[model samples]
Target: MADPTRAARPPGPARSALHRLRGVARRATDHPRVAALTCRLAPRSVRTRTTLAACASVAVVLLVASAAVVLLVRANLERSAEADAREQAEVVARLATEGRLNALLPLDHGTDFVQVVDAGGRVVAASQNLAGRPAPTRDGDSAHDLLRGGDHQSVTTITAATPTGPVTVHVGASMRTADAAEDVTTAALAVLGGVLVPTVGALTWRATGRALRPVEAIRAEVAAIGDRDLHRRVPDPRSDDEIARLAGTMNAMLARLEAAGTRQRRFIADASHELRSPLAVLRTQLEVALAHPDPRVRSDLVAGALEDTERLQALAADLLLLARLDSAGRTRPQEPVDLAELVRHTATARGVQPHPVTVHAPAAATVAGNPLWLGRLLTNLLDNAQRHARTAVTVRLDTEPASGAAVLEVTNDGVPIEPDDREKIFERFARLDDARSRDDGGAGLGLPIARDIATLHGGTLTVVDTPGATTFRLRLPATPTPPAGG
Candidate 1:
């Protein structure tokens, strides 16, 4: 049974109101503006980076705006005060001209007060709020004297004239008042900022994080998969963006991994199954040899069984060597070696058991190779030649400067091999369907192994048919000989 809380509640304004508020909150947190801001900020950019940027902008704006507001306020207030003083002086000028100076210089004028002085540096007439002292002036010069002296008073100054022997008037406005007003304005701004800055910053940070929640979720999900679950995928962000690109790349990598894993598993299974027969045969043959009684039969069986075992061993060795050569092909360098000397040594080694084989190689005939691998390559080729030929095999090495390469060829007579089968003959485990092939008792890995080694060394191994002869050619990069020991 459903829990009472889990049970569906009948629709009403109370529940509907809460649901609507939650939906609105979710929309606000994941707003498009927040998402756009998060996207404009790089993925590599962290929360600290965004916060620092916002704070820096706020600092610069506050500093610049506060400076401008202070400057403007100070200028306007000072101008207005100077204009009032100038008008008062003008009134004094009018009154003194008509002989009524006491009327404008009213003692009841509390703020816009005025003062008048004579050329003798004394305040002969003054208004309220400035009656006891003379008007302030530059040191060592009387304010009245300066007022009478100059028409234009500089830097926080104003002047006017009267009729009685040029009555000089000096005027001033309070700078302290201007500064105090500026301080008040800045303080108000700071107070407003104290509340608003944190609110905006917190809202921005939370909204940005909420909008990028999908990306965060994807990162956590991808991290969890590791190597064990390529099948698992990150939920695609519905928007077409960098996250989509990331998902695409991941999916492509997963496909490649899945294919490679499938191939690896199949390869292992095939290798195990293929190797079993030879291993079982060798084990059973040995066991039977140990169980035999008569000397003659035992000797013959042992020799035949030994040959099979050697063949099996040879096959395994060739398989491993071929695999190594194949793997090394991707990374090995093709350096030059003396092809003439290499082939001659290889043929001599193969001919040690007295098969009718002759080798001829010109002195400068060279090949690009690892000498060890080149030796093995020629050895495999000579082994094949020895197995197939009626009696005589002739090995030849020649260099062609025109082609910029050295060529080595092994020719065998008395076997009319078809041209079409040349390519097929190089494949692993491919054998001619004949008693001659059976006589050699090879697992058919030689020619393919030779081709692999040759290819690894930056050369080609191919058969060239000439009527009744089959010549296997190995063409390689020409070896340069430095002057004898120089």
Candidate 2:
């Protein structure tokens, strides 16, 4: 059978309550308004935040450490007090056992209260501090030998089995002195904490500021750079760190932007000059026709004006196409185009020129691209070849077996381009000295536009060096055509 006392205790509450409370506290800290408020109150810089978080963490750790120290010191002091009281009580017990309780009267100190009591719970003798007082412990529960009253005093009792009966000796040590020492220690710790936290915070702030000085300097330098002066770069610390890497990356980006800006300025200047030439010719022809009334001169003036107008219109269209290509979005839909067929058609459509063109194309060389752009690319390549060729221009279209890429080559049997000038030929407004005249080169944007179109289709148009001929080669990703039945 179970004891009545054992059956009376209630079951404990579930342990998950503590976990739920912790979860709630975590969610509360994550609240948006609280986060916003914290951000507002704290410094915005990363250095400041890191420093403050470190200081706060240090302060918490210090506080916990000080509390632990205080607890340990208090525990030790209490143990020492109890030990002293126990020793005094043991001494008193010995004297009482020897029947020499009266001998302790002159040796007594006022701080420690000692008493000798009989089994009857009556005080037989007492020290100077407890003179005339009854026994502190009675029979039963209080008669048990123990230590108690540790706040202002520490009392210990020990029973001595004397010749007559059991005698209890009680000794109480004053806790006033130990408590005073604890107070002094606690006060000192509090002062140290107050001084240490602020000192650490200030030092952290200064150190962090010093570390971030280079970043601020870089920011100021970059900010001072205007659109016209993208050539300026941020100063690098040269250390292999995140900050140094950031500076390097920024300088690289600035370099690209400067190059692009220079290209844009040159493009605009070239376009303006090209436009002015045609407009001036058209205006001069119109003025000449008004001054002369002859039909032959009038007809000549009309033809000249028409030629200038056509050139102007072509230039405007090319500029518009370039602008559209430069935009971030694509307006044309991508589809599988027969590059071989496209090249053959563009070559056949062009009028008879100084050169005879020959087309060598496979039946089905397909590539993925906008059909219109691909046709324009072929047209530009053919036109360039036709103008430069002395007697013949050969157009070849086929798929490369290794890479499975569609290759289109326009080879002109003309004066070969210099090795050094091959890359420069694809730049907008780039013209060779021999073809600088308006009649020979049509605005010099055809090659650049063709290259841009090729790039849009994930392809490349490059001038390949030949033994005694000029060859413009185009490469596009090849796509397999579906079977007729499928």
Candidate 3:
């Protein structure tokens, strides 16, 4: 027995054909070569497309309007011609009633075909245009009537009462006249379109090109700017328009870029100088040890080399930390950190023996931050204070209930930083020391890194001036305490 569970197979031919067609369509749409060819065949420039579209739109509108006018004029002309013919026929019928039909027969114009039929259905009188034609209508059958004899022959007929009896009148103007009028209208419209469309297209092309000229100039200027020459700016027309605004905005951006480039170059030069000194000293010490044969001098040289190596390592670590801080989307786990305890710990680490450092925190001030980075920030602050202090360093932690922030202030009895130099202290590789020596100032990145860390933790580090003291103040958003009952 055949297996009843077997599923029936679908038909192959129609499905296969559809699948092949779909595959072809996908290839045509998705393939790069196909897309490139399509682009090549299409209008590539905005000017070309705009001109063509404008011309086509005008052409379509003119065509539809001209068609409507031609139809209305043709209808009116046909109506007028037919009405005139009928009126002439009525005149002929009246003449026939007066018994002067023979005089009016064989009319002069020959444009209208007129015939008069008697009550007995006999062709009694006719115009020259219908010389041998039979009666176009039956006896007494003419009342706004159209009579067609051949494919192209037609007449408008009407019946009127004479003195003897009623007679039929046949009248028709040729179709050629109406056709000729429409033909002339169409020919004239064609000629107008031929002239007008090209003119519209040419004007559109020129207008679009003129409008985009400013943008083209901006693009060229931007393209010509090199890494070494970010100071160059695009030309501004100074008009109160979009293009002018765009140029102004671009120039502002270039100015900012140039400033940033200047800072970067300065930082690199400073870093190179800092690194070169240690490296040169280390190399020279090694070379001196090689030249000398004394054991004590070799030992001193090794020690000096180790010190230089440690300084290099410290500088490298600081650079890496800065790099990480600058990277996007880098975050660390946050927890409540006691600012008072951190300040005391950093002050102790920096040695309170020599400088007589003191701390005052009446209440616990807590902030949400990474403990490691917070510790680094405290260490940097304490180090800076100890380095600049003349007598003692004082660490103070307090909470501002109004702003809900924890404030840590490290004050030293050092010379007050100048008003202009205070802001410059936070810039990378900036040193207020006139010598610009790394040995005395420690790579000049400590304050910048400390400020960056404080900012990352939603805080700020700034130098606050007291009467005779230089104080570095750090402010961090305070973590709120929970309800007592809860």
Candidate with the greatest TM-score versus the true structure: 2
Give all TM-scores, in the order shown.
0.53, 0.73, 0.66
Q: TM-score of model 2 relative to the true fold? A: 0.73
Model 3 C-alpha lDDT per residue in residues 309-362, reported as the tens digit of each score: 999999899888888887724463369887778777767676765577899985
Please identify which of the two predictions, 1 or 3, would achieve the higher TM-score against the true structure: 3
Give one digit per residue, the lDDT tens place, for model 2 in 1-486: 898975675444433776778898998899998899988997888887878887898799889988888888888887887888787777778877887778234323423677788888787877765567656544444522332333477677788987778987777777776788789888988899999888888888898887787799789989999998898999998688888988999899999999999999999999999999889989999999989989899999999899999999999999999998888255434588877788778878875676778999999887887899888888888889989988999998878888789888899999999989998989998998999988887789999999999888878889887989999999887765579999
List pairs with backbone clashes in candidate 1. none
- 1-486 in candidate 1: lDDT tens per residue? 787864677558878998999999899879999778877775455655676667667767877887788789978866765666666566665666565666226622213445766666567666665566654555767654433333322222334455566566555433456667778988877876676667667776776686577778878887898676767777777778776777677777777887777656654564564467667766776777789887887787778777767766776788789778867856645576777777777777665453567878787665556888788888877777777777788888777768768788888885867888889788666677752343554666778888988777667999886678779998886655569979
Error of 3 at 322 (Å): 2.4
**By summed lDDT, which 10 consecutive residues of candidate 1 come out lowest?**
148-157
**TM-score winner, 1 or 2:** 2
* Superposition TM-score, candidate 1 onto the true structure: 0.53
Q: For candidate 3, list the clashing residue pairs, or say none.
A: none
Model 2 poorest 10 in a row by lDDT: 142-151
Name the lDDT of candidate 3. Answer: 0.81
Q: Model 3: runs farther than 4 Å from truth?
A: 1-37, 68-181, 283-305, 329-371, 391-410, 434-440, 454-461, 473-486
